[model samples]
Target: MIHDLLLEREQRRTISKLGLDLMITPEGNIKVVEINGVNSGSSGVRELTGRDIDLEMITDLAQNGLPLFHLGKLKDQVFPHFVSELSHQQLLAQKWMHPRAPQKTARFVLPIVPESSDILEGIIWNADSDYYVFNERKYLLINPFAVEHAAGDKSRVHALFQGDLLAPLRPKMAFVVRANKECDVSDFKPNTTYLVLKPTDEMIGRNVIVVPTEDVFCPDGSLKEHPLAAYRRREEGWYQEPNVIMEELISSKKIGSSRTGKEHNGCMRYLILVESDKGEITIKHYGGYWRLAPSSIQDSNLQRQLVANYSNGAIPEHISDDDLAEVRKCVDTFVPVLYRRMLRLPINDRPDDLPLEAYCY
Candidate 1:
């Protein structure tokens, strides 16, 4: 099941790398919260420590100038290829390699990619569709398209797991509009019940809001603009905001160094690898990380939202092996279903794998 899913191809090439964001609920259920393409770069270290800890900058120290590291099929094995950034000096040095005495001072040439075409590789820290389109033979650490499918939409991605597989891992989520044609205001609780509104395409938890459903509509039965809409920053700008996916609030136990050690809401992150070879796929468990918070998420105030994403002051912590075992079970059921739904393929389709019910409109 894993092999067929990973090895499936579009056109003539297989997806090489994928980055996923997994979350563990308060009740200890594991769920996939987001997926990222190869274009995903780690800002965890930077955000956690406030330093330029990019791999490219570190690798530049070896005089290899930012070469791409290809992870082998086996974990822990990596291969390096020289791909250097473009520079004016290098361009001039190439132009006047045999300069006469009039231009004898051309010796300041820096190390660069031997082939000009590889220059693009230096500019990219992670693989994207463009990276695969440009270099087919290069091995990637993960597949790019899988990342897009997993992280692209909140409503769609969460809907896929509404059934037995990771169903317990999911919170109460739904696609909601400003005015519900069927749902009446009586069904909403003014302050006790909270719903998290998330933009479909934004990242870094930008434009995410947690609000009381009652506030979305006015007494005149018309939709009222959410106050956060005016003050929040978004990937596509404020006025151009896309439709949102609203989920009922699920409180998580404290998973961080809160002053009171209160059971504040939090999420756990797991990193794993899916490797493919000769039409076979296998998932390797790398380990698990964490993101914790001191408060329940809120967005109505237009302040920095209380998203548990690492960027929002979430510090990393240790998770035990027992916790990882639970996470593994969720991924085992999730990956195959995710591959099937996203690709519309039956690589490892199971009749029982169908979502228990349609989760969204």
Candidate 2:
């Protein structure tokens, strides 16, 4: 499903890498919960498994005669530093360029700047001139516009890309409330037992509110107030400032650990690399790791059981070959459909707002 999304984006822009946060339901269904374009988990996978997946990614691109440029802010501290060290050890040439720095050849650009920031100080921007910047540097600039357009708006991407092949794999969205709009409590149907309220652009489980329609009970089974009682009543402080996406809560399958005799509700992080060379696209599955919920399946806290995210103190487990094979089968079945859809659409028929220069090759 993600490969098709990448292919669709490639028709207008160049995007080489993408990550999908998947949830396996009790019925053995794979749900694509989130799509990550920038800073996908090469580093986290390494940290969890002691495998240098990022280095493997670099080697793969290098062998394919493709040089990748890492765009990020140094102050962010994690990815930029890790990529710098990895590139240095690989003997790959590296250079740092500020947004206002004179255009120069560089394999890596530190401190990723805004898309509207000046690429060259005191010079009128020219695509022709900027083309040389990439060509001369012998590297592809991971376009910020492409990243934002493709992954920033979660609700938009889901709406635009649904098909017979994708519809089953995606979680059902309840509704979308535009930025700064008030969420009408009535919009949530009474029969809907569980729902997820989150910002459309946020990642790693931040600012997520999981609401259960009925009142939740304490561990002792005593009745407690519902989590969103305030929101339901439209309390004074309750306001949805950013675009809020309401999705039906899809419960994860319980993963049993034979060695420990315990079970967990888990989420998987699958990374995929899409390389475009001479108009032919190649996709490689980089394997994945499992994030187990902090508490076991027996825990009473539904929030912890539902959201298995690394940033939220979830435990990382090495994914088994069986699990990888299952996910691979789903990808194999869906990708061809996505590709055919792209092929049917003529390039001239693509959206007019897409930047012409974004077609990297």
Which residue runs does candidate 2 get wrong by more than 4 Å?
1-15, 42-44, 66-68, 73-139, 178-192, 214-240, 257-261, 277-279, 335-361
| Cα displacement (Å) at residue 62, model 2 | 1.4
Sequence-dependent TM-score of model 2: 0.65
Candidate 2 residue-wise lDDT, 1-361, digit = tens: 5345445544432334567788888888888887776456544577676776555655565443333334333223343213442332232233322222343533333344466543222111111211222321223434233333445567655654465667778766644555435444443343346767777777777767777645433444333543344245543453544566767787888876433467888888888765443345557888888878877878899777767788878777777787799998876676444333333232211243433222221
Model 1, which residues run further than 4 Å from truth?
1-19, 39-82, 85-142, 146-150, 166-168, 176-192, 217-239, 256-263, 277-279, 294-306, 343-361
How accurate locally is residue 145 in candidate 1, as Cα lDDT from 0 to 100? 35
Worst lDDT window (10 residues) for model 1? Answer: 343-352
Clashes of each: 12, 1
Q: Please, what are the lDDT tens digits per residue for candidate 1 over residues 61-179? A: 22524345332112222325434442434523543121222233432222332554322222223322321212323323234333344455565566566556556556555554432
lDDT of 1: 0.46
Give the best candidate by lDDT: 2
Best by TM-score: 2
